[model samples]
Target: LFGKKYIVGGNFEYETELGNIKDGKVLKLQGLSQKHRIETTKMENMLSYNIFASLNLTEDFSLLGSYTSTKSKEYDSDSLTIGGKYKFNSVGDVVNTYFDNLSGNKNDRWRGTVNILLEAEDDSDRTYFDMDGNPYPGDYAASTLYVPKLTMSLNDLKSKWSYYFEGYYKDNEMFQGLKTNEAEQHATRVHLEARWNDTFSRGRYGINIAYRNETSEKPQNYGKKGFREVKRGVHQIRLTPNFIYNLGNGFALNGSFTNIYEYNYIGDKEGQGDFIMENQGGIDYSGLMPRAFMRLNLFREDTWHDHNNATERKRLTQIRPTFRYFFGNGAYTQLEARFPIYNGGYSNETRTQIIKSENYETRYGIKYIQPLAPGLTGTIGVTLLTIKAKNKATG
Candidate 1:
């Protein structure tokens, strides 16, 4: 890292020409990647980073090729990328981009090097579990990782895709990827995501799809028998399509639809793989101004699960409202509230659903924010009221 501000990178290239062809060349290849982080203000309270592959040529210029990943804690973003980059004056400005990008998509073009990366590093992490109200102490974290990220931008049509796979067959789960034929002894996790965005002059809209996979297999040499593929390989997929549009004066419309699918494997092949399907939707409205703004959102979700191959159904609805007003000297007061209008989780499951429930909870809170020092902001929040109400019926 270059002084905690910018990430440094280098490339090596060798180019040659073909003999008996007109305007044609055959070039051999190598590989390079870049990761950088830009420091933001304390008020932002975000962790932002970017990673991308390199396609270098000539003295100090190259067009961007493929594979880019960017993440931020605040704001729903798909991906931020550019056409090409040029380096002339300084080294820290390697990924520096000009505002006048060749691509017509002119939404979030950054000046100077703005990129990042996140690497999960650990010796070994463990977790504790409970079964039948009895504390069971045997859980493991993912120790190996192989992530391949990809992003593409053509004018206003953009996409970000990534895959994080933990381990393969016969490799050690507690170490890096190497050619081996041994028993892997620990549990693992997988994460994959794909998102697309279309940002124009008025507002932005996008669709996000994510997937998660996990395994809970036992150790290679544990329990009454040896390790097997008994309780392992579970999957979950979430698809969300969202939009926010401007309404000219002081109001905007926003909403999202979330669809989910799940699968799992248990004991031989007797257990089901596709066990659950969920659908959720939320609508939001915002009243905006220069110094103050407020937002209100309503949501509804319908989901189900499985146990012993007997499926059940569930449904819920929620409402959330928030308001914030800014003071003269960067001080602000905000209020937020959330309550469930309806919640039902039981509808004929003999294995796991013993009681049908509805009406879960209600919450409300308020907070004040003030600037304390150069790099600090003070916040005081209080939960004014909360109501927990549940109605149960016969199973």
Candidate 2:
């Protein structure tokens, strides 16, 4: 005897912007010279809300819930969230005596979830860097955020097998003058699975295990003054046995093999010591290391139809390729390059570079679009970046 359902939704948004700039070394007689110019304009607004619910405490017991709220007063933010879920069922064994199947059901299952979040901000007219170092454009400044979460799952246990677990927590705050910034974070995850149907020949197989843990704190004008803190962990094991032979002409073959382990911890002690005398001219503090990677995927599908219009129109395609190689004990290898440009959709131009002893780095981009007719579209983009520092160590 049970039944219930409900849902609600909301949304509203608006944004505007304008800008102009000119100053090429004071216009040294260029085909077009605007001497020196600058213009700017902006406006913004946003609102959001959401709610949902479900319940059927019988014929297998069940319950669910959800909630979300958001508001953006021109960048001064706000946020919220709520969540819930529960389910239980099992049968076939006479003597199962209710109570959600003696608290252990077959075709079996158990689930749980919880969530909470809050945020706040006040920019204070902006412009900062005081305490005598210069640049003091003020409006005060304020910020806040907090989050919490939890999850649990166990499905089809007796008939085969499955398990999952998750956890999370966070807190952040910021304020200008007398300087005050704070941070905290925590994480946990676990999973397990096992399956072997088709008894002996027809085919189906599986085995998997995973684990992760994380911790962090040290934010408030960052590093140099935040008395840093960080910790990390990861472990994984996977073995898959898969097979399918329908042979009706649509061929198939699948494979899987994974083994991974990782660990990291960094508390920037003088930028992790001696990356050129503790980042001499500055930047490039390699701390926290331990890495590994191995991933692969392969898939194929085909279909076509036009045999006398039997209401059949079929066309299917799929192609996937991936490869990764990295090993333990602080491995290092990386390359990045970027170039960008786009207008309206928003992007003007952007470039980035990082040559860590030539491990690798490359990037490129360009974008610009603004066509309000025949397919309406708008875009703008711009970006540029480079890194490799530590040069100025003279006793």
Candidate 3:
């Protein structure tokens, strides 16, 4: 970020991990009961840091802030975040709070954020194959954990279409960081979008839709004493749609779809629900192959689940291909599933099992995207986090 009034950004990360592991030949005081295999050599390390800032003095007011920290052996954390954009409403602290200008455009309409967290714990990182649980591994007792989070954003930008609404909350969240279920969350989201691009003989298209809802708690943090981490209770819903098109001389077309639903409860056990669907379709090309481009995709997924009266189903399909080329500073490279391994060609890789988030089975792959300076770059991994939260909640 450069600066209009003010802007700042920062990041630092360090990580290391080394191979070979499989040690489970137990039977003593330093371990529990494993009864088998062994092979070793492992190493790990991690470190993280981040910093952020933003501010705009007039035209209704704006401000933001951030801080983050992490160390690992599972985790050790710290976080702090602040938010702003104001016209009316008053608050204390942060320099006595002042943001006069009462709506002269309210920075295009509201934005807010708040986050706080602190975590620390170490119980020798147990897990050596149960057997009377904690048969060994340090001594322990509860210690440290405090979490808080909130986010709110609402917007509607002039013409050409747009929509936004967002809300989220947390107080004891740790799902996806799962160290034995942990939860407490609330979420609300809405998005809408529209576009009619230009420049290829003046033709292109766009569409977007989104919805989300959530609530939760189960085995959530702050649970201990014989792992007394609560027991299920949740409700969730999600819906998404996306699209793109540019039938111009260079050709393009795209699609997307998703659905999710869930309900879970537990008392004496037995109560669950789930249904999910994932879809995709794509086509792209760059006539004449100069900077080169070609993309093709087709993917599908299905799922269903219900508790002890049982019902479960799962399905999947796939085919994704890409061959990209570009160079001259903003480097680029791509080749995926370009087949051939032990002779035969053609592949989309599949190992049959699916819960999704990919794990190449025979899916050939190659990637190279360089330009690591001048705004720095070198990254890949796209679209997820609920479809980028509807592309940043309608921009």
Candidate 4:
């Protein structure tokens, strides 16, 4: 057995803007005046990095990993992951009393298994042109992804079934000024489930199914009449069903449902004539969405004559309530609002963007949490966002 653990964190953000541009549009110079201004300044910077790792090889095995890197002068991103697990018996050494076993069947009937996993990721970028202040290059891009996974659990063919499976593959590349594009993609998934119990009204039930597929190859742009190609495809299907009910004073109720489907391939002799895959003629689009959620809970406990009169019972309290609803059709909506002020000791967040134009956009924010001692904690927040666009016709 071997073990290792480490963590480090970092973050920095800065943004500044002062503006005026009358026929080169990108404006939001807040209530502009001062004779229609003509002087501008803008600056931005961001950086981040994170890494984590873990390993334990006995008492039911274990292994885990993570990585992240990011930078900005323009843009860069990275990611990675690894996994492991194993154990066939030892069954958590049979617990000491939770309503006295309540049927988890004591110990050792197949308690662990899941042995291989591999992951990968890549992101690419290049774009520059700041002129007189330096930096120049125009356009370039890249993308990559790979995944491998496997799992096992059938508990020696026992009657209350379970199963799982997953698969993935993806590749992509692009170049702007001389036109170059490459693409490859693949995916697979499988899952099976079963459960049944009823000793006079203690119930549980389940059912699930899933499938997916995707394909792509379309990118090319090296203007002045030369190079243009585009091609794409996608397909998907999914279904799920579930239920649980155990109300003996510590209430319980649950439910589930999901469905999806999509397919598309668009034109210029079906080789995406670049300028973002010009479909100016042939088109295919489809959409469907459904979601629902509900929750409720309450509990409290104290017994055994208050622990034989040594009297100490004050820990077991819970409360949960939730609700959600949704509907769709190429839909859109947004709203925003924010305001903030706090006394000294470094705290500032000023944000504002209220229901601005074209379709509907709104945003709102206000947050403050401060306690500089006794476990030290400090935070301040203010946000405002607005976006709305829909109007097109230029020939």
Candidate 5:
């Protein structure tokens, strides 16, 4: 019963930028506007506090609680966290529960100040207030979030394999209006992860799985009249397994796989299911100077709106290989190439007059770096690309 303290901190930031930026890589429509290029100013202020206390109830039990608050213009929130652990001395097992309540504001905007020039109206006679006489919304789009989690983990590392499991539930409510623009969401998640390594192989591997179910209700535009409430539900599951191996001699291989499955339903309609899988692999030859690196990536996805209909599947495979050489003069040269293949089609049950399509692409590039002066450097590069396409029935 000796630890109790309170800490306070805050900060302020301001930024200004002038002139517009032009880059060809960016689309014209998404480029910055010319009018606002004159000057733009941003200001932010934040304040926070931390309060913690611990009490020993008995020789076998203890209590801990903490409160934290953060206030800012762009992001604002406050949270209360309290957790405790109970130990079963006879069985050497422990159970823990942690609870948190976080509430905050979102999307703060100032919307007043529009000049309306009416006929024969002077500056003093014109109305200068915002359209609704209010600079911001009444509620400021405030939201409350709650998450309670339970975790069971092994504290002792006597075994080569260790594992932990965590489960949590979340509820978030945002008040827009009572029925017009209000929003509420609820979700539950379970996560499990494990890791194992062998000293003989000098390799390590890990696996993780997560499952979540979420439902949300929010306001939406109903036709041309106004806003109405809508409900949506989602179910998602993901699994990931990865590992790395060292074959020695400055060579190593690493690979991982992730699979995601999701089902979405809206109102009373039949839900649709989506499945996607990604695989990534890489090989590094640090055995050589200026080293050689190569990577392969594969992605596939399948979507089924209804059980009676055929599913659509798409696949893509990519390979990237590069070689680089470094000079003692602070210069380097690199050669790179990319090969990718794309294939898409409908299931046989759903196939009609259309045929599946396949596309192949190959690219090659060479780049060189040289020291032009004491403090100046230059780069030269060239790239070439080719593409080909065909269909099931086409030669």
Candidate 6:
């Protein structure tokens, strides 16, 4: 992007990774497991910077901003994003706002991840491989994040239906002291959309919805409230439908469907327990040339997990199909397929004890492009795969 009237830009980056390790003496293949220490060493360094700005502030208002910085020796971060926009001339409208701030230095010991809520334990699924047993490498904390957003849209409407809305907020924190392993979280989000069209005819349709909510608290014994504050909540909902069609010599078709629902409340205000459900669909096709394409997909998922006091149920199914072709000098061809199924247990099992698994896969590929000499080009490819499975156990 370039400037025109107060539009600036900047970018800089540096990266490095070097490795050296030798003292080897480990090898014992066959069914795995038999290594007596193979050493490794890696050192990484990174630096980054970015800057941006835009303004035209009067003619219906506008301003945009950006700043980003990153440094790593294991993490250091910075970010700032700003946005604003407003315009309305009768029925045509637009509104937008955004804010962001992020800061970091994270690495809290005992196998990191902010100390995993001080090595969480509520009824043991066991984890905590060392500290008193020796190898406990972690500790470097200080983190922060905040985000805000809002959006509204309905532009140049001459009516065929149009609408959009959005809202968002997020906050996260970690400091590793204030009671012990301090952590915090909060989230909120919402989105909506609607559409219908034939602007010039090719068809279009759309509907979208989204919602999210989250709350978390830590410190319930990391120092006895020094920051392991166990409190959790999460909720999510989503629905989507989209379509597009244009079937004329250049062909085109598109489709989308999605449904997702989730709910979880643990400890701190428990009720409504656990839940999850998901569904997905996809379809796509494009003319036979100029780089052909095809796609099909379906997915389903269900969960009802709730620990120790038992409640378990899980189901998953997935299917995917893909095809691609292109040839002119840059030859290409591809085919792909996948299927998956798994059904789970508990919910007072039955249905033959409810546990099943199935899987199948296929893949194909071909590529060839050779015209070496004058602008040179060369490529070669080969790929093939096949897989099948049923009821688990495989070798």
For this target, which candidate reaches the highest lDDT against the unseen true structure? 6
TM-score of each: 0.50, 0.23, 0.23, 0.24, 0.46, 0.23
Candidate 2 lDDT, 1-395, residue by residue in tens: 22344333333334433232211112222343444322111233434444544454443333544444444433334444444444433323222556655666443343222222222222223333433444333222334434455555555644555555665654443222222442343333444444443433433445455554545443223322433344444343434444433222222233433433333333332112110000001012112232322222332211212222322211111222222223332232332233221210111111222211111112333334444445334444443333222211210
Question: What lDDT would candidate 5 get against the real structure?
Answer: 0.51
Better of 2 and 5 by lDDT: 5
Off by over 4 Å in 1: 1-185, 218-230, 266-270, 273-289, 307-309, 328-331, 343-355, 384-395
| CA RMSD, predictions in order | 19.1, 24.4, 24.0, 25.6, 16.2, 27.0
Q: Comparing 2 and 4 by TM-score, which wins?
A: 4
The residue ranges of model 3 lying beyond 4 angstroms of the native Cα positions read 1-99, 102-106, 109-153, 156-234, 237-247, 259-261, 266-270, 278-301, 309-311, 314-395
- The CA lDDT at 167 in model 3 is 48
The candidate with the higher TM-score, 4 or 5, is 5
Q: Tens digit of lDDT per residue, candidate 4, span 220-271?
A: 4333333344455544444455556555443455443333333333332232
Of candidates 6 and 2, the better by lDDT? 6
Residue 26 in candidate 6, Cα distance off native in Å: 69
Residue 133, model 5: lDDT of 42
Candidate 6 segments exceeding 4 Å error: 1-56, 62-83, 88-145, 155-162, 167-169, 172-190, 193-225, 229-235, 238-262, 265-395
What C-alpha lDDT do the candidate models reach, one value each? 0.49, 0.34, 0.48, 0.40, 0.51, 0.51
Q: How accurate is candidate 4 locally (lDDT)?
A: 0.40
Query: Candidate 6's residue-wise lDDT over 1-395, tens digit each?
Result: 23434666666666654323232224443344653343222124567777877675665656777777766544456777677666555431222212111233221211100000011101111111232343222221323545566676663344466566666555544232233443554455565655554433876766666665665543332321133345667676766666767667665566666665666665554655555666555666766556878877776666666554456566666676777777665555666655654422113222334444444555565555555555445555555555554553222
Model 3: per-residue Cα lDDT over 76-115, one tens digit each: 5566666665542222222233343443322433222232
Better of 2 and 3 by lDDT: 3
